[model samples]
Target: YRTKIVARSQNNKMHTIISWSIPLGNNILLSYIFAYGLGNHINITSILLPTIGILFIALGNYMPKTQRNRLVGIRIPTALNNDINWFKTQRIGGLMFVVGGFMMIGGGFLGMISEFWTIALMILPLVLITVVPIIYSIRSSHKA
Candidate 1:
């Protein structure tokens, strides 16, 4: 299904690049965390949380580069309707992603202090990242 979507999309190359990179990076980070964290008795959550944040940051950097397609990105209906909306949404979404990434990274550090804070930080940013972009995309679409 994904292959067909990418194959048909105008920016197939970027989609392909992102698809390959996301998994590869995730695997590498997970592998290292398990190998080193377990051996050294380091808290896996502490390391894993930050690693996930860094991944989000990398993804955020790529978000604006993506073109409208079903294979990757936010994929909201409003953004998908037109190129201008897609572009604006992607740019805003990218920023939100980066901010969320930083929040996650902070959550990693706070994980040592309180589980509640760690969970809150992690979830709140995720919600904002998703909801904010969709809202912006929808409102922007209405205006246009």
Candidate 2:
């Protein structure tokens, strides 16, 4: 992880990390405030699920811009070892995130009616975002 932290270029890694972090951090902070501080006044699921979706979309938008760094993007051995895999993985991962974001937003709405369906939709995206990129990185590395 220490080795991974070393910046490969003058791309201002901290800026990238900070750019990614701020929205996510704000979302989490607001979520906490909304969920706990005003839990009684607001519907937790309505705000939370959609906020999570926006975070996912924001992350997805940032993914392609992420260079190989310990702090962000898809960080698997195969992706980390090479630039090609890193970019491809990030691109696919970004797409997955965006797709997942939409599903999650839909889940926020659908959740009101069917909690089970919302959970099912939400879980599949989470699984795909985690698994697909790793698998793609591995397979792509093999091809090279």
Candidate 3:
């Protein structure tokens, strides 16, 4: 992929620059940085960094809202087994992500959690929430 910029002045002067490389999608890099608690101190940056990263990750993973048996979306085997279940699972997962992200962001301001625990606090609920739908979908599928 390549990006280019061109600018022209009233004096008829022009400047052009072109860059070529795979775009480092912000989510990919931010997730790594947030995973490491890069800006995680008892400060604004601490809360903002991870919150932004999580939001990007959530948005990027669940865009276009199509039902699919893919790895990134709601991939409950049962959900993938049917289109309606897939849609419902994805919607629920997306809502869970939003709630989880907000919770983590709110938790960041509390200052009671140590940096280490903050990372865990932010991640664990999301994992649990993500898992619930899969488990439910499986059970529901099996029952059917």
Candidate 4:
């Protein structure tokens, strides 16, 4: 039964230790806990906003790579019916995703804005990002 403890250093590095000691209850292995600086405040919005931004960017890049299948990527009913519709929609959607992703990344920095403006900023981009692609996909299906 052993325990390991890792500590943060002055230069913001980690020190790893291998400890072998007495066994725990019922010969259980020792648990491990990694801790950052004490009293470190993490900003939730900062982490989430960039994560979502990166997701959109990744999705944008992925859209072009995916084949038209019911299981993955953007799966709209109308778009699903036609390959040409799917391809065009994906291309436009990919572009929108890239734009939307950048907008979300930019929104992550709006910590100083008023709540009203913040909501407006985020909502508008979201609607543009998602709704427009759906509309475009549906319309293209009609044309095909």
Q: How well is each residue in 1-144 modelled by candidate 4, as lDDT tens digits?
A: 111121122111111111111232113211211112444455445445555666677667767655666544567998778888888888888888888877777776773455554455567668877898899998888776
Inter-residue clash pairs, candidate 4: none
Window of ten residues with lowest summed lDDT in model 4: 11-20
TM-score of 4: 0.66
lDDT of 2 by residue, 1-110 (tens): 54454553433543565577678768776877876765546545666677778778878877877788766788899998999889999999999988898888888888
Regions of candidate 2 where Cα sits further than 4 Å from its true position: 1-42
What TM-score does candidate 3 get on C-alpha atoms?
0.54
lDDT for each residue of candidate 3 in 79-108, tens digit (9 for 90 to 100):
878866767676666666666666666556
Of candidates 4 and 2, the better by lDDT:
2
Give the range of the ten consecutive residues with the poorest summed lDDT in model 3. Answer: 13-22
Model 4 has a clash total of 0
Query: Candidate 1: deviation at residue 37, Å?
Result: 11
- Model 1: runs farther than 4 Å from truth? 1-41
* C-alpha-based local distance difference test score of model 1: 0.81
Question: Each model's RMSD to truth, in Å?
Answer: 3.5, 3.6, 12.0, 15.3
**What is candidate 2's TM-score against the reference?**
0.76
Give per-model TM-scores: 0.77, 0.76, 0.54, 0.66
Better of 1 and 2 by TM-score: 1
